[model samples]
Target chain A: MEKKYEFLEHTADAKFRAYGKNLQEAFANAAIAMTNIMFDTEKIKPLLNRAVDIKGDDLKSLLVNFLSEFVYLLDAEGFILGRIASLTINKTSQGYRLAAIAKGDKYSDKYETMGDVKAVTYAEMEIREEDKGKCWVQVVVDI
Target chain B: MPKRTELLKELFEEVPSGVGKGGITKLTKEELLDLLEKGSEWSLENGYGTKADLEATEESGRMKQADSRQVSERALARGKPQLGTLGAGNHFLEIQRIDEIYDEEAAGVLGLEKGKITVMIHCGSRGLGHQIASDYIEKMEKKYGYSHLPDRELVNAPLDSELGQQYFKAMCAGMNYAFANRQMIVHWVRESFRKVMGTSEGMSQVYDVCHNIAKIENHKVDGEPKKLCVHRKGATRAFGPGHEEMPEKYRKIGQPVLIPGSMGTASYVLLGTRKAEELSFSSSAHGAGRALSRAAAIRQFRGEQVARELMAQGIEVKAASWKGIAEEAVPSYKDIDEVINTTVKSGIGKAVARLKPIGVVKG
Candidate 1:
């Protein structure tokens, strides 16, 4: 069993790593990890579902876009989150495309939100493959 | 600043429906691109702020190198609705009173007097700027794979490279967006005051400066004039008196450096010094650097408790999210006094006045 996600220490920003058996799982966990920057996922409920479609030129770009879309939704549209329900990635001639369904609801006073995530940064963002076909994605978010 | 409770209540509590989400003026793709290209000039043309406000801003609130073509659709979309908003996280708008004056002459020059009320705003270019940075970092990393880079975040492109130019251009545009965004917010703040208090008293931009930016400048190196790209990250440019970049009114004195403290701490206004040009490349620390991480702060303190403590100190706290208050607690930041002392001792900045918060609005 792989760890879903864990926090890492950074001097000025919030850093984290998400682990999974494949890239897609790692990507999904990464989204949840970013959401964790704002709300403690355990307390939030999936009441509003938002579909996300993003195109990027590479795997790294795809992951960044996937996470950034969630940040935008939360900031611009007030779509708070419990989790990402379904996420899929496909290769394209340009590079890679991602489709994800984020399940969450408008922020209410009932749930516990620790902080607001301002943006997902490229600071130390990476995707790596491990032994036995495991994948790990790392990101640092600016709060 | 007084008798404006009703308007303040509405402005602080919710975004007006006509102003779009977050109480910001929404923009179409074209308008946003134009804004990216023109910056504060676009805001001024649209009647958001006055010419004096732009003069107080860095580069007169426009960076001519900005190229909207380099900006992406996602970046545009993310920034479209956020214009004029006081963005979330540690960003805030605060009402303060001048507490102490260190240099009476400099304080007078800056229009600050003891017990005088002032409004200070802290924010950034929002999602568009972040997205631009992300997009460029990826492009730079791919072009020059970061095999030798010690930290992945420190990815760089050669200053003369095509990709580097593109990044610089996009970054300038983002800087412009931030300028216009802040200008519009200032406009709204004045309106809110006028609508409720029947006056826009004590609402003015003292000096607006960018802490994170790279500018091509000529500085003396080894007694020879050399062109350098000065990048000030987590730092403020402290141009001394007589510098060409200084606005006409400020040229005889020095650039006004606004250093804001964390909640419950004292903020300072410092004058850029000539010694800074010799010692620090005309740069100074932006604020008190973080003493703890957000998680550490959350673990150690509660937002409601912090709010109560601030209220006890006669500081009003209004927040879109209380958790934000906890993450940015006073304990989470370094001592502003020590930071200012270090800055002054280093000969980079000269203390002019100190400000204590009376009211704060955080998102």
Candidate 2:
């Protein structure tokens, strides 16, 4: 499915708007948007492979944890997951669990740091379905 | 919509606010840093509060891995004298009453009952934090020419850059200073209350959280778990139940989310939910988003009239500048209730209790 992503400016921060035909596509696009904020997307290559699992009670929280974890991977391990191989989300009695594999090359050049996100906040967050058979999520990282 | 003039008038009179305003206590630089890193723990150690106070604080009043040496001497100097002082705008020490309980179980656990008086302290690293941000921004802008960046406001340096690390360390120290400052103020507030009521009945900290700051953490994104730095400006973390950070007592309920409203309105206490993990990096809004600019507020309201209105509502206020008062009128902010509602509706947090102001002290 085709997807579109846009960057929105916040007070000393940046937010991304991702639209896709399904949740997975939207999330993938969102990942692209976030990494693009730090470096040129075209320069990044799909080299290394990594997998992640996240749990949350709702889509919004899960999205935040997902993005945060991605950023963490880049900052701590210097690994960037440039491609989404497969993604699956399941709803459990406790919450939602997400499992997926990402592929990307390791960051070599000292990546510029944008802002240190202290923690994800609950303020002004929204996730909704668009008129097209697509889903949208608007998230504001604390940084 | 409420008239901005009337709103400004009411806010000026009820909420204590201003810049460079001193609070009831003073402290030295060393003393302030101790508070900064130690947070409420310093207060407890100094006999200003009890151990129970730490339980109510985020991170239990201590942030590990803070590199105080990274703090600049100038930043330290700026923070030294400001310790124990509430240096103005939006910073306040309010004495309030638990006028309502939204979730009885949560309120009971929080040790709050209707009619119980509570004190809320709102301030940050003050000059120290401001100086750190300023110094880093200038250095980064000069080197990176971030002015040409897509968003000039998002100016920053590489994470491993000397400037970046220094800012992080200094910022942590500043946070520590804030923790200590609020702890000291809590001590004074207790003393003042004891004096006013002629009783030694001590008060405890409900919770202490920083809304503006950054940190490093581990999370999973797109199924890949990684470590990243999270920065929250005008935001707060709402870690859910069973998280390692949650105090044992609150693990079942989740982390306490303190949401303060405009002076005339009600503040809320909420608990984090697991759902927040997906939504916002387990984050939430800090407060009602500003609805009016300070200049607009000042132009719309008269300070004196605002004070009178608050007094009429039985709320007592002490502020440093009438202009400051006029600028923060309650109407100038988004309805806090709505903001709280959004949080709950989004399933990030659950309402616990509501607090109404009885007395306020602004800087």
Best by the TM-score measure: 1
Interface RMSD of each: 3.7, 15.6
Model 1 residue B194 CA deviation in Å:
1.7
Root-mean-square deviation of candidate 1: 3.3
Off by over 4 Å in 1: A1-3, A19-23, A40-62, A73-81, A88-99, A105-114, A122-136, B1-21
Residue range A19-132, candidate 2, lDDT tens digits: 777787777777777665444556668778889898765776577667756755653355665667878878999879989898878765333221223233334556777776
Per-residue lDDT tens digits of candidate 1, residues B209-281?
A: 7668888887888878889999998898998999998777788889899999998988999989988988888
TM agreement with the true structure for every prediction: 0.89, 0.66
lDDT by residue (tens digit), candidate 1, A3-101: 799888765788999988889899999888888777778777788889889988778768877887887776567677678788889998989988888
TM-score of candidate 2 against the unseen true structure: 0.66
Candidate 2 backbone clash number: 50
- Worst 10-residue lDDT window, candidate 2 chain B: B15-24
Off by over 4 Å in 2: A1-143, B1-37, B200-202
Every model's DockQ:
0.38, 0.01
Instruction: In angstroms, give how far residue A48 of model 2 lies from its true place.
Output: 64
The Cα RMSD in angstroms, rounded to one decimal, for candidate 2 relative to the true structure is 18.1
